[model samples]
Target: MDKVDIQASNANILKDHGSDNKLNVSYGGPKIGRYVSASSNISTGYLLLSESPVGSVLYKDKCGSHCVYCFSRLVAGYPCEACCDVAFCSPICRKKKKASFHQFECRYQEFLTGLGISSIGRLALRLITSKPFDYFLKIRKYLNDTNETLESNRSLITRNLDVIQFNAHEVYEFVRKDNQNLKPSKQIAIGLAIYQRASYMNHSCKGEPIFDNYGPTFYFKETKDRQKELKDRYWFNCNCQACQENWSLLNDLISIPKESLSYNKKLKQDSFKDLIHFIESNYVDGKMPTESIVRAIDKFRTVCYNMGSVHYLNK
Candidate 1:
């Protein structure tokens, strides 16, 4: 999919707990669920969640010219005087981040960069440094109320620190593997972030909401991931519609003739936009038979692959 610059999108969509909003975080067993607000009726491609970053870390190698705070790419950025690795889009963002997490992280830049810590590890540090002990206590209390336990012994801060360390491995495996260009040191810094509400989302190969990150902000879209990756990283057996009915099963059910199913079929205009339009207009939104929908998706995937547009599969 096209990398969404979430920084440029509608800002209000990420606001917390707005009355007219389409997204709401609700309790559902061990995990939290982000659902469409009772009053909202979202269409097939609608965005279901937008979360602002509570804490974030930049990939050291890939983000030299990107703003360390907002993550906006810049031809040239104002470098942090304290650490050569960090830069920012504006003075305000730099100052704000510094006052929060960077002050502590700045001192350990060399060690952090050298150790090649995973992004989640960096995020755990950021969480500990940015928020106070009391903050963690409040969070612990809130979690405990929901039947979740964040055990700690000496103090709330220590307890929360332990919790972060424990959960880092789980979070680390889920880090996206798409940034192949990152050098070893930079790879350690690969995008890591935490948004309070966004963390609770459950796994689904055909998850209705997909998120794109631009710095600390995430833009949500309706879309779909691999079952093995989800289970391996997130520790859940996916029962999403796409996983339950494997693509092979769907492919067999297509009512369209074999000739029509061929990707080599001639089109008046063979272009990505045209193919997408054809599929959406003809098969999306349950407008066609189930088999036809499956066929259209298969055709779309084939066209995308042939055109070197495999990114579309993620959307």
Candidate 2:
């Protein structure tokens, strides 16, 4: 692989090193497996990842409950006619699943769970199945080469293992704690998603968690010790202004009506359309769409309201 002179378009924006634990392929990257950084000349609206998420899958716990294909919550979900183990949100999802990967993995559903596949194991399996047969052939041939060094093989395996599991993030961001019908006792991770670009983003105590559409993620937790919860789950200290100054969760809380809250969120969603349109129209190659990008980020200002959507607070 190293002998090939191929270069990715995102070479400047992203660097993939062999592994964080065993290799420092990305020069000067801290705690590195992969890192993303935009070049100074890049524009603000420059897209980093055109399309991503190498792969994902529904966790065994969510199998019967969520769509085996799209991982959406089942609403009169369409079942795999052949097996009772999985269902889909729509016939389209079911068909797509069957056409792509599910058809191949269906027979194994009976015992893969019994084999006790961990979160990483499931995603690894997804990674394998998501690829074309030729892709595996290429990898297998490389790994099996008689002249291949053990150190190279070990390095590649270590890197793949970390990227597949350690950096994998939960995805249940939309399934708010109180929003679903069939409630879990606590925050439930419905699936897993790997947004490699965002791995380079630093977590701020006040920042909203980033999630992709592919897999499971967490939502609610006791808000009593916000900082502690942040530390335990996210590995960050909540030294943001709220925690440093000891702000109250309900201090002078303005009680926005449930209807208004929903409306505002919708408005926020619409503003994104406007922002995207403006960037598409006004942005010129090599020039930053500074104003539009700022508008996009500012749209999240109201997300603080999610702290307790009236429905969840009332519950």
Best model per TM-score: 1
lDDT (10s digit) by residue, model 2, range 1-315: 455322343344443432121111122333333334323333223333433566777777787777877666675988797878888989898888887767777888778878986777777767767777777777885664555446665666556556664467665523334543312223456777665555644311122221222221111222346656556655545444334554333323233333422122223343445444443443332133233323333343223223321123124
For model 2, what is the C-alpha lDDT against the true structure? 0.50
- The lDDT of model 1 is 0.49
Score every model by TM-score: 0.55, 0.52
Off by over 4 Å in 2: 3-34, 38-52, 138-148, 151-160, 173-188, 202-315
Return the clash pairs for model 2, or none.
170-217, 171-216, 171-217, 172-217, 190-216, 191-215, 191-216, 192-215, 192-216
lDDT (tens digit, per residue) of candidate 1 on 1-315 = 244343343334436532235543333333533332323444333434545666776666646856767766555677787888788888888888787778878889889878987666677677778876567777775553543455555566455444443233211111222333111111123355665544434311132443322111001111124555555555555554444544434434436544454333343323555555545554533433357655445555444333321111121
lDDT of 1 at 93: 83
TM-score of 1: 0.55
Give the count of colliding residue pairs in each prediction: 1, 9
